[model samples]
Target: MTQSPAPLPPPKQRRHLREAASLTQAQVAERMGVTGETVHAWESGRTTPRGRRREAYAKLLASLTKADMVTNTQEAAPPPQVTVCLNKKPNPRRAVSAPTPAPITPTPITPAPITSAPITSTTRTPATRTPASTSAPVAVAAHGPVPASETEPAPLTPLTPAQAFDALYAFCAPALVRQTYLLSGRRELARESVEQAFQLAWQRWPEVAVDRDPAGWVRATAYEYALSPWHRFRPRYRHPEPPPADASDRALLDVLLTLPAPYRRTLLLYDGVGLDLPETAAETEASTPAAANRLLNAREAVAARLPELANPTALHRRLAELASAERLRAAEPTTVRAGSERRARFWTRAAVAFTVAIIGATALTVRTAPTRYEPPVPPGETVQGIPPRSAPGTLSDAELKLRAKLRSGILHGPQRLIPLAE
Candidate 1:
């Protein structure tokens, strides 16, 4: 009795056949008149093709694989050669002409035969050769590849100002806020710091979008602002309830809080935020070596608090787990409403700052101004106007009459006096 062939696993068979035929899942689906997801489902072992669909799929796979094999074979084969006979036929349009005799006409033009010079060989090295014409020397770069700094960076992703802001906020806000929260140990401060950073980013999106590390820029800015002393006096500082901690976490938090701020930030950034020592150092305003030392010292301190964490491997593993949990918890999506509120708050703060500056300038101007001065004079005394210098002469009767008439006019009249009220 003939034995039946063992059936192949669906996913393996599908993947092998598609890859062998150099086809994508989508391409296979297109041939089968099914959605790409359906093909993915079959190949991922999530669902199986059945009945008529299964038969049709098998047939399609067989045909495509066969066609691919035939195409490859044809491409790999060499071209055929064709031979030509030189003496096959001459055209009847014109037969080759016989050479005519160049007879006695050349007798007068005969001359002595010229002597031939001996041939000689000389070797030339290509490197030392100079061009026949004057030319500038060509410089060859010794370096294998141009350094990244020497190359112009590609343009930033083509995004409208609004789209850039939205995308950056959506991608980085949660992570930034989370990192800030780990630093400040307060949700409200974290939220405020992240919002402020994003506000600045939105206002300067052109610069920020082209930055090599825009998210890093945002995080560093948020961190600096969160640590500012002015936040102590904010009336609206509402601290949200801390995330629930198990016994181990409570112990970890106790140890973390007891450490110095620098050590704590280094450890958090290294493990919690998955930043390397150089990056953590830059963010915390410390040198890389200093940051490394701080991390080691902080780890030892934590080990003292929890003896079981003394082992480096165990410590790293536990920290990694904690960081994973923190990320998962902090992954809440930032909404449009939140962004709008942040923008409004930013403008409000800006206006307040501008008004304060204006008021300060005005006060300073008033304070520094020179006081007006009037020459001291006795209460009852008046300084008379200097009399005009004139040539000494006796005036005629007509001139004297004119002067007297001018003195009687309104401009030259005596001033009226009014009595003060008792």
Candidate 2:
């Protein structure tokens, strides 16, 4: 008879759910599709929660990032301290001036139960890896300890709150934008994705603020927002596609965009960022096998555009000859919604208010017209004619710039956009 593989080991201890969800064990258990006893058992590591139930469990964990619920605990058996290489990316659109956190370099996985969980740190390793070159601000506990035969964890310094936010911004900003860019191929639209994630983090910064790994919080937030396209979650986005400079690139992007978000992210994270099925599974919170399927589905969908990844381009060409059926579709124009219009108005009003302030400053200067003092003329223009000048204002150029900036500040400023505008 066939022998079954061993069960997966226990991850370090973790609270079944955090308080941010404001959910109790009973509520979590209900969402987890198990008995309260089962929830306790899983958290306690008495027995493993399996199958579709486990998927549901992961989904709940991913979504539970609602309010900032900060909990630090170990599961029955801690997961191996594997340093995940962060996917480092630069946003082509926005200017991010923050310092990047160091790269994560945990000990390689080993197959033994070890004491003292290797805490996460923020330090930089060489840019040996792509995308995930940055370090994690927090060392996250694995769902279970890795095999003892694997790598060892190396110690590194942890980042400060400012560093953490910087790292968080850099880490998630590019990844989220890239995924959105690949799908929408529009910078403004991609920015919408980034802004949504950012607003959520700001709203719940207190709880998510302290975690060693803030990128996880932000990334999870981005995914959560992108998960549903309901009106509640939709943000105003009025981005136009950058006519891909190259036809091939344009075709490639079109094909890539056609895939669903789950698959789209999986593709970019793997192909563009260099993550494997298992780790991709963890980041996206899917089972390794299920994540594999999502990746496959995404690839299949893009095969036509990215034929080499899916099928041989030469063979596809030959097949095209045989089928003799060519179908072309007219591209649909992008439409900006009402909320986006409101956002646009907000910026416009701010611009107008700023212009008004500048005009007022000019008027003030005219009102404070310098006393009309006749210049003292040096006697005799026989040599070099020069007229004496009067004293000017006291403020320095730097001080004047500061004054101008401050007086025009929007602090306690009136609302820029009207609540409802067609």
For model 1, the run of ten residues with the poorest summed lDDT: 111-120
Per-residue lDDT of candidate 2, residues 174-222 (tens digit) = 4455444554555555556556666556545567675434554565565
Listed in order, each prediction's TM-score against the native is: 0.43, 0.35
Per-residue lDDT of model 1, residues 1-422, tens digit only? 96433333467566656655556555676787764445655765645676667878767766766775775675466433222235567566864443322111111111111111000011111111121222222222444444646543354445456665665665566556656665665667777777778777766766876665666677778877877768667776554457536678667667876788789778877755545466578778989899999999998999888999877557655654443345322322345435646777888999999999999999999999878976887688655897867897999999999788656653534765343454
Q: TM-score winner among the candidates?
A: 1
Report, for every candidate in turn, its global Cα lDDT versus the true structure: 0.60, 0.50
What lDDT does model 2 reach? 0.50
Each model's total of backbone clashes: 0, 42
